[model samples]
Target: MLRSIASTTALALILSGHALAEETTHDDHESVTLYRVFVGDHADPKITAFDLDKPDNRWTFETKGQSKLYGVGEGAAVVAVQSDGDQVNFIDSGISLQSHGDHSDIDIEEPEALGETLTGPRPFHLIDHAGKVVINFDRGGYAEIVDAHDLSEGEVETVRMPQARAHHGYVAPIGTGWVTSVASDAPVEGDKAPERVGLQPVAADGTPTGEVETCTAIHGEAFSGAYLATGCKEGILTVKAGSNGPEFAMLEYPSDLPAGETTGTLIGSKSMQVFLGNYGAKGLVVVDPVDEPHFRYVELPFRRIDFALDPANARFGYVLTEDGTLHKLDVLKTEVTDSAKVTEPYSMDGDWNDPRPRLAMAGDEIAMSDPKAGLVRRIAKETLEETGTIEVGGMPYNIAVVGGSGMVHEGEGHDHSGHDHSAHAHSHGDPQIYKGYFEDSQIKDRPLADYAGDWQSVYPYLQDGTLDPVWEHKAEAGEMTAEEYKDYYTTGYRTDVERITIEGDTVTFYRDGKPLTAQYSYDGYEILTYEKGNRGVRFIFEKGEGDAEAPQFLQFADHGIFPAKASHYHLYWGDDRAKLLEELTNWPTYYPSSLKPDEIVSEMLAH
Candidate 1:
């Protein structure tokens, strides 16, 4: 919950203020619809609200709560927690009171406080499911649930499983509710607490017995239908809460693979599924607990910090990279469709525990909460442009988005009484009309056209310490000299290249600038491989006529291993083979250095 505002984070606003500041000149008596972001300042223990329609606008809300609360939950209202572990406050998300408008008066209300009742060993996580807020205490191994509205009095269901030592757990709303237990045992005399907790399953009454199962590092849980999935070092723990309540099963990884760990997880939004991230692998393990327990792997360049399924479009989900880029993935194809740079390099160079930005998708907006900047960047779902930003006080850790259809009423009795209050107007100047100029004229502007299909950049740096290669260069409306061809080819060679010899297709050259050879026609089973030195090369090819254009079976004579052929396929360690094929197919799509060391190796192998 570190919330120091980065005074060094620079904001350059060079666009014409007149264009964006044009007055709407609405009916003075009519209630204006507004969505305001309220942020809690960690350093000052203060809260402020910003008008989403006007970036330069702000309002301050008084808070006697804790100064360093990690996550802010937005429900039918905005919930703010005090840093001192004393109180929680709620702000109406519906119609934010405007300071300059007719609604100048501030609407403030203090509900209930946790008081001394909340001061436990440690309040690790504050989670909200439905309207109930639960605070988990690690020291006491218990959970306290609160009525989100009242905050003072609610049900406190405490389950003391003897082997439960809090690591990371999540409470999901099923038929009732269930908490994932981080397996642990009671303290023994003269025995030091082990680094990892060996699993001892809880019986029907939440009591551990029987043989100790060697399971450690049980992270969070996500619910999909009757199944609740939890990520563990062994694989995944699948639980079903049905007629019999909750039943548990373990889905382990392939034994033949190298020993790595599994930590991160995200349940599939549409199906009876979930995703497990192998800290050791480059790809994501797609888990369908009821169907295929073994899971399938979807490879990508960077290790995903977080991902969100587009509730609007189930085929797509976004993966935010450490380098501050959001990658669009087609879940159906299990392929990356596009990517765009959103923020400056936060980097993966520091300690894994260091503060960084996390991503969350709220309605049509995709937001990244940058703890270092003390800002929440709001990206438009369609164009992915930074449409707006609000300054919050404390470092935001976890965010839960609810109440999308939320609306504001003039008063509690302002409910619909056979009357329509949505005053309609169609001005010639729709906000979207000037959106283009707004983009072209701004420094941080992102164009909508860029989102048509998937966009990818080359791997910025290769394992060999060389730059990525590029594939093609046009001869500006006329034929060029042989020297020009050679120069372009040399440029492609210096960089990594994606061989897209087909017309109208765009390909990238690696950072080093290696040019692709002439457009070659292929027929039958034509296999081409590229390997620079010993490591294998990963290449993406464009479909063309015949088998030559089609993928081929690649085998390395030195290693005696046949690598699979597909434009987007995994190539772990094919020294000479990777280099030659990359030389044969498309140029390099430079991946940023933001990916972790192990992630890069895994991504390359999977490709």
Candidate 2:
């Protein structure tokens, strides 16, 4: 659940070996995981590593006295927490290699400890925040933060629940502080849950700031964009970003749901501000922080085994039922879109520590761990088909993947730092609903839409103005007025979309009397590529729909080899799909000569 990825986006390693023999050059290669899964054996002190490319081939490593693996991720490093009382250790997940070239073979090495911190009675939740790892010592009533890069020892901060004893505490880092549950001042009551719990903003320096926010029998928590959702007895607590710190707003439990309703587990969207939460055992609930009245609920036939969201694919996530069926959750639509039985029913009427089915997302695949069967079943993306399974030698209670794509130069002569490409900073920035869009042939048909008409375009230029401030949300709850929201979000589209005829799959975006046809390539995200004089242009698609009916608006960004200071253009099909022209158009009065406008173009252009 916790993945501590190193800053790989900023780090590059050389790969070619031919450089010493002659002059050489290198190109950029994006990060990728080499290994598929690391199954944590509960029956023994070992973890089995599975190759994504070759599932039959596997490797097992001994973890000594540790009986569990908490945070196994494909990030730069994997973390294993050891609870050996006062000698607890947070050790290395395993050895993984990264390169700067196009491709590099996976390296195998012995496992060792990354570092150590307070060896407490028990270290439970291991969360990866930003780039650091937070280890929660439940027994010690403290949370320790360690630098993910070096695993250096960090300060341990105390936490206390105001009314009831904190059986298990949580800590999530935001900006320079943490959203933490307080440790109770008194011991927990017998065979009884906490009547009320309190949460507060805790600074990185261990001091509590802002007013303490309270919830009843608080449990599940999740984060997305500028919003953080925490589940409690009443409903969900939404913490919004703020200049002073984060502020909490309570959303009461749904009125029609009746009594005895509470959320035990929560998973937030990777981009949108919506959360998938467990409503006791009745069913699953999709809670929107801003819009709470229309909560989407999907009932379960049996109890839940485990559920997880696909970090890379925003459209669908999955839920594994105790009946062994994996249901595909159309997140935007908030419903069960597809389902398949992955394993035999694993009843939930047993001890909490009993081995059961668990779910996780390994890249684009949905992996289900069948602890009783000692197997990990993977579901392919898009198709919702069985991709096959991998066998671990023991009870695979937990699984995590470690390894990413990298490159190595042939010769030592090439300077890795010398490969300077156009910034394309807008596209390079992290994927956002407006900032990026990708369409894979596997996800949908060749073309998503067809248009042939004169589309009007209204262009807005900040003129030497950075879109950052307009796009960034600094409010406490990620909530803004209609006017405020439109200002920042509308800046990405053009109001003046001109002549364009789209009839079926044939889309001829005319440029200077010539047509730029759509041809697919590159990770399926780049929908089409066309030539503009000496430079080439690529169209990428993205949607920001939080509903399952599909994205109401399609976002396409034009990524070209253009200089940063040069003018550029990006737009979308007008909001009205019928005529494809009547959409909201707002004009920017100021256009500075230095900023240059986006080239949407001659007969009109692609998003």
Task: Give the per-residue lDDT digits (tens) of candidate 2, residues 540-585.
Answer: 3333312222223332222322212112233333232322112112
What lDDT does the true structure give each of the candidates?
A: 0.41, 0.49
lDDT (tens digit, per residue) of candidate 1 on 81-146: 552454544554433121211122122222222222344444454555433555555544555555
Candidate 1's C-alpha runs over 4 A off are: 1-51, 54-74, 77-117, 126-132, 147-182, 186-214, 255-259, 267-283, 371-374, 391-402, 406-607
For all predictions, the C-alpha RMSD in Å is 24.9, 17.0
Name the candidate that leads on lDDT.
Answer: 2
Q: Could you tell me every candidate's TM-score relative to the true structure?
A: 0.49, 0.58
